[model samples]
Target: MPSGGARASIDLSSATIAVTVHRQGATVPILIDGRIVMPTGVAIGPTGQLYVGLDHAAARALPADHRYVDNPTDLLGTPTHTHDAAPPDPVELLAAVLRQTTFYAAHQIGQPITELTLTIPPHWGPRRRGHLDDAAHRAGLPAPTLVTAPAALTAYATTLGLTVPPNSCVLVCQVDRHPATLTVLQLVGDHYRELATQQITTPHDLDHLIAHRVIDAATPDDDPLRTTINHPPDAPADDRHALLESVRAARHLLVEHDRAPVLLPAPRQPAVITRDDVTTATQPFLDTAAHTVKEVLDAADVDTAHLAGVIVRPAPGIPALTERLAHATGTTPGVVDHPHALADGALALTAAHQPGPRAAAARLPRVRLRITDLAGILALGACSLILLLQPVLTADITTVDSYVVGARTSVPQIGSSGAFAMLTALVIAHLAPTTWLAGTPTGSPAEPTTGSLIRRGYLAAAVSGLITATLYGLATGTALELDYRPYLTWTLGAALPLAACTALIAVTAPRIPADALPTWLALARPAIHYALLAAAGMFLMRAALSLTIPVDLTGMPGLVGSLGAALLGAATILTITDSRVLRALAVPGVAIAYALVFTYSTKSALIVAYLAALTWWAVRLTTKTLHLAFPNAGAALHRLVNRPHS
Candidate 1:
């Protein structure tokens, strides 16, 4: 067995154990005092007798009805027992084995094993997984992290220093007492994706073949051994069971020795079985297994040249099977000889990788609220309140320019600002990060890619801007006391410019050059930072020009003429250079030209632009402050608010 120091120091109450349940038996491997130890899965007989490790000799002695062998193929099907009573539930039988194994491991470590990782067959679906989970719960074990056998084998290969590059394929073959299972898996980023799986069955059972050969060599054709073999049911149950057990023992012995002796029933001498005999028996199974590996590779469209490694499990080494696989794949296969290596691999993978994106989303709501989310809520709430109470809050300051003659403030009717506030709030609430966009936690199988995040950010900004313009148009039209037809025209006119600007920014932001940005702006993502900066500068300049420019020069006729010229100028400048610095520099000139051509009264345009800038600054500052004050809590809250409910 491979030896090494413990990978992690787990607490007694929260210790995790990894278990693999196969046709032969279940194995649970645990770390104790820096060494890995395996405890056998124990099953309870119907007669209340305890069978530990399902010893071949002891199992043979039990009545046929009471013999327990795990049948993973039919997890929900109960094995037949005596007709006197119903057999133990398949789930219950599995539970008994898991419970015994868990207690044994806990006893060795002097602590409770509160967590579990289980290796499951690749083809099993939700029903089978749920059944296994029910068994674990019945055994008083924690809900296990179920990993496919192929994934576990791939993980074990990595621990062995077998480097399979990303996007490459690895083949794993699991051979036990039953048919060998062949699986092809591809390494995608940090996780393994199963490509194909097949089960290879031999024409004859290896144990029966070995037994028949031994009997022929040791006894004459007319011997009682030949008669017993010819009709198993006619022989005494004890003799039949003894002969089978002896054959199994000899097969195991030959795995290490070139030759071994198999004891026959009474009045018969022990027969010597050579390694060649065992090989002849296993050769058919190995050939089938090798063919299945090639077929699985073809099915997965993976070439032998792209196959980075081949891994086989249940390691006391299957030399013939290994050789066949190596010859077929043109790559020497790595043998995991340690009996409990599958369980160990499961445990190691659980420790090394974080949950996937879906799992992280499910757990997001339970996460504690952070300071950043609280800040966002407060900032948004404060904006809504101010907008709703705008008429009352600014009732005293009715004049924007006291020095300029006839410059009276134009306050909207009571419900106009309130309606805009309600609509804006509704739009923003719905635009919060969706489930797919929220992504996984750090170090998870997959994280939100940079491109996806940028797209989401731009989408939010565009949607928000469009909605804000619509709300503004409705309120402004109501305050202006315009007729329905003119109001409709005015609303459309107001919305179109904002929409055009949003599209313009979206198109330009990505094309901006990195070196063209100032050193201060280099800290943030180029697209997001530039978009935000351009938006902020636009509003700030609009407010500055509205307050400073004389009203006559910004009359309706002059405004329309200059506004069209300014747009043409800005578009030309954007086409000429892809520098964000130049783009930002052009904003002030555009705003100045717009103010000269457009009649934006000091009381209306100035206040709206100033409020927009104030809200953006407040949100930005609050987010930064909260992140610095309570770093962890702020991050958690950000994820919660942004994470999609679905």
Candidate 2:
């Protein structure tokens, strides 16, 4: 806090940048002897580090007679704005920042930059992040750890003096057009703890906020910018348009809305929001929010009688919403000015309550362990590896264990191709969640979706493989003779499990929820159950085949052939029945007749394919029925629940 405490050395004036500090005749915040200036005309490295952008606007801001050591072209965003400079490469952008900073810090200030930090938007991506880190390595600065937009907002929140009460709850509600976030914080000794963070958006808040802001911003008497809908009304609102709209809305509110308790940007109008206005604007958001608060209380095992009143931080919308929540819950709630709660709290939590960098894995969403004993990061790594190698691994149409159509015929080729396809699927599944997300959103739906079916099918296959392998090992099966029909018999065996597993799933699937468990755990449950069911199906199919057929295909290795054959049948039955037990059972009855009428030359591959088709159709049908029963007007879990609406 002293004026001359040693500073990090970096010359801020070498470039055409200026630093401005609002202290009483004091210098700007600087690292090492130079001043700190607000960076402008910049792009972010993949990792969200800020890089001086090459847009002419940046140069334009600099004095006409400024000079630097490095050429502009060496940095990313090479071509000037008028010349259509290739948008800065993310990695180069990151490298440029470090290079520039390091050059200033080292040669200019005689110090190796050891620590670095950056502020970035919340929705940063992985690829871009890698480039930023790479750039930091090339430069002398230590690679930065990400600080989210909300967390950054915290710096501002603390300055505004928002505090939570003892034993009292504080809910920080942040609203943006794309989403509404509610994070409840409970104050404790010199720190606060997280109660909950919900990912639900209400319809009232879902509209293009920019449009509304612009409408609100425009004053009847004095308007500045003419508003135009860039694309059609239904076309998605772009970033530029959204920002402009926000500016306009703030202006409008300044002039029109009664800014009493909460101040508006206008000098005369303080922000005004009544409790009733908040309740009406938010509606049932409070209902679910209140429930969540109660649940949080129960989870923490906190008694309200021992607590201080509640605290509410209103986001973009009316502040009254927080008050309404307080009223409904019978807890006296306190209020904080919005926008900076998350960031400020993050810093406080770090210093006080948080597990710190040492136990960071437990706090990170990516590393959090699920009840199913799966780690998201590991799953993601596996998926990425699979997708990257899919073309090679699953290069075959027909495999050695399974038949191929329009695929390579050789055995080695089958293995290679199978691996490639699987790898590809694994990669694709992670990157594009549509396939996985297609399933019913509800933790428990009467009927599942295509996504669920696919998820379940793959799951069944995996579990069945393990079970079959375990059984085969127990039997100590030796290298036996391999014949075409017998090989085919083994292939069919794989399908049998899939079919039988799906059938059993169809029967009891409704009783237990698919989504209720943690994501990793939930994903495994369906697969494991399906595997057991399919295994049962195969056992029965072989029993029937050996008893009836004269030259049985029973003597197959790994029980794989039978499962392969049964898979298609089981999947088909489940798919066709729309998750109806009666309808699915009837599928076997019909298939038997069809096989009798068509031909006795039944192939295992054909059966598996048949079951696959059935699974698809049945899931689609079941989902339709489920959708009718419980449509997703809001959160998937929220809709399916039998809450007994009075």
Candidate 3:
């Protein structure tokens, strides 16, 4: 490349947008004439006329009927008077600027503009890039290559021979007229990746800081200056615009010299703003910028000792900002030639990668997954574990708590809230078998027809049972004073009766076809298994608590022993039987005969009979839900058939 060879780049920022064309191989990167415009002020009227470079004041002053379309790419859903009266889009606005700049550069250099590159923020995702690409296409430019701001800055830095050592981390502090962004970039081998980034909103803060200082420097007689500086929202649009532009100019001038003269409305002397005044006014903003740099580094998990240096946009040369950045990052910051360093690096990137999907994807540093998902998963797991285990662990602890309940003595009657909750869970579990059966695959030879619903129901029931057990434990801890903590014996004792009843019913009960049931009941079969589990679990917990009518089993030990023995013998016979109706009647027959012959008291006999009847009824319902409706019922039946004498 020759010293005078053409190179062009565009920088689009929220506050300002500029196109710079410079020589490729020049020593200082000689800047030819360029076009600069306020991007925020770019608006299109209802008349389809293109308006560019209007200040914020003029934009807000459009007639009540007129709509302000600041960003062209966002006007997709905006309504127009008619198809013919459709307004210009963002692409047109962008194209017009590019066309104007290209024409200007071509006339000055006596050659047609060929290559153009664009520099954008690293955080701007795919959608924004697509918008820019469409705009460039409509602007009639060979899709200009796109580059990130940090990449462009690094490119310009390399050109200036201010490159950081390989593997070193650098923080880029981008403070423009819009919001400030602090990006941490690590140079790995020869490539750079963005480690972390943070955004800070300080646009108005800086402007207000400067404006306040300039106004304060005036004489006490300056009431007009005070009022203009205050800049009420209801003020004329043009006046507010002038005040904003005035403060901005003073800010820029303060960067170069000690003092800048600011001209305001009449009847007030021009305010002289010193660099010290600007520093004092903007101390908070500078503090925030410095803090943001440190935050970005912290977010990336990089130590300050590992930092290479902080790189800031060049023009606003404030030593206070440099000192604060050094203190925050433990490294003195370096400067680019100007904010245009972005355009320079963009030009470098354009030469390296051509415009295409592959090039664009490869050029972008791969984004890391968000940490929030992992945090959420951890929180959910912790809550579930606590819910499951809290009751079991705290059973003994409740004994101590019962003593501390301050003697609100009442009748020892059981409340129904825990029972009701368990019942609800039971109903839902009961419906699981039906749902699984309905959804089972029937047409395929590869599919097994009988066991799908049963397996699903069992699974659903087991889940619901565990859930109900957790709820029962929690509720019992709050409602009753019983400790079942050494839980293994109680668990086995509770399971024995349920198991025996299930075995007997499976051997004796008549098999019912799932489709023969009512439509509503059939649909609910899948959830019924879950309800059964919850009910069984709650019943077990009640048994473990020894909660019953205050009858003393110890007073009639002989009767209790006989009752227990009779139940065991009956369960064994029914479990081993071949006849279905006989198996079903066996337990009831044993209970009735035992109650008539062995009982000394009618209440004890009635209690025995009631327990037997309830168990048998539950067993019958469970077999229907499982054997007929459950997908895995055949396995249980097969196990029963193959069982030996034991």
Candidate 4:
């Protein structure tokens, strides 16, 4: 009922379906629904819940037990006669989409659209149309006009006031998601009639082929984006969506421009897709498109010499297609100008035909959200709020730092406000938007082996933590009081956790394959998480002791030294995974550790022991060696420090 172009149109494709409404007085058509869902994907989740459309749960690689039916059109396959078998439940899926469309029309136009003029592909015969009509009826729409896509485009052209010579032939080439189709329409006394339709199936699905090419060309084999594409994460879906959009945009730009830069995430360079790239990648598709034009003309028994005009569908990446089509048709091609040309034509036909009364309003099905989706939303909100408060938090921390350092300061023990800011900062770091992307790898077998490996990693982290605690305890003596804590505790506490995480990786390296180690390391780095834990521990310790160090110049060296030591440990574990590098680094590391032991007391012994353990783990793991005593050693240290009499 929104009526600028006289008829509303639906452009349904394999990728997504959209409805366009022409507002009164507006020259151009407006798209009402923008949700691009998979037309073929209809699935039932683990809970026996039907989840149709482009949903993550359905799109993701399903387990063996899960039920997913691709290309649900078969479910709606047309019956031969009245007593034919009933169509499958996937009819509900198509009906569900129609009800949604009806709801959209009601909301936008303030009335239900019972009489719709459907524009379909020329190849969709009576059977497909029959199924479509059935779906519309089920969705509460009455019998509507079904117009072929080419005829609709011809109608749209006629509405646009483009004159067609009587007894002449016009070829309309439509390039969409699936394949290229060329339909010959014969003009007779101002009316366009479909004469022949030909579908070119070779070099199929150009968009999909081009996207894969761009991805392969732009990204390195080791890049996480490739892994993400193959095994999609439980996402930041926007990134995944943006990646595909960039590829499509690149393809479009390549049609007109010499080269276009497509932005991909870090570690993956932006793809500079060229016109040559498009032509080369989609050559087969262009050839197919061109070949289809000849097929349609031949089928219509029309000669290329007598063809009145050729209309190419206006698509960004189809200039080459147009060129191929023109060469085949032996006529200069006119671009369709409007993407909704077919829709516009259908709208005009419906206006002229004047179908039955509008159908009554119908209720649409509800889409359910999973628990993980809710948690992700909440996490995203929390992260957003934290990010907004960062500047204020930073200012507070600076003020506290100045108060603690200045000669005229009177802030008692670096107040909770300052500590709170530090804690918040730790939280913010952990909650970074990229954290989800960098969190975990998908498609790892959900078996006991993986579970055991995770347990080992945690145990290793705990052991490394205990070793650090015991080293500090030994250095400062059995009393280990908070009063003796150095000014470097803040840095030491923060750095300790990262070191433990590094140690955790080194300890688990042998259990995991060499090829899989890097990605696992990237996701399980736990540097930020450990930093938060360390900050918490330091906060508790400082609060218990009512202690705060006056900011002094001398403390800087100790803080830097603590950070350097932690970094040294981490770098050693991560980079020296190679036994040759491990051996080369270990000698100097041990020399330094020994010197610290003699010069800096028994506390230096802990640092040496920690370094030695890390070096041993790296060396042994690289050489396919195993150490059963490592976890036990950590347990001994934990008990020795905490249970003094045991």
Task: Assess each prediction's global lDDT (C-alpha) against the native.
Answer: 0.52, 0.37, 0.51, 0.50
Residue 415 in model 4: shift from native, Å? 99
Q: Between candidates 3 and 4, which one is better according to lDDT?
A: 3
Q: Pick the candidate with the highest TM-score.
A: 1
Please identify model 1 stretches exceeding 4 Å from their true place. 1-52, 60-84, 224-241, 314-318, 355-646
For each candidate in turn, the TM-score is 0.48, 0.30, 0.47, 0.45
Backbone clash tally (model 3): 39
lDDT tens digits, residues 164-234, model 3? 78888778776663466778888885457889878765646566667766667664655554565576664
Cand. 3 Cα-lDDT = 0.51
* Clashes (N, CA, C under 3 Å) per candidate: 7, 78, 39, 3
Q: Candidate 1 has which clashing residue pairs, if any?
A: 315-336, 315-337, 370-637, 435-644, 558-597, 559-597, 559-598
Task: Name the better of 3 and 4 by TM-score.
Answer: 3
**Per-residue lDDT of candidate 4, residues 1-646 (tens digit):** 2111123456543234446554331223443344422344566556555545544334555665556655445455554233524323656666666666556655665444545666677777777778788877887876657777777777777666666777888888777555667889887753567889877787436655666577788776776666646555654554665676676777677666778887787656677777777777787877667666777778899898667778766557656777777778778777775556666677666554542111011111112444553454344334323322221222222235434321211111122122222223323222221223333434334412332444344445444444443343233322222232431242234334444444453444434422232333344322333223223322222222222332224444344334334433443344334366765667457435533432223323333333344334334432331222122446578778898573
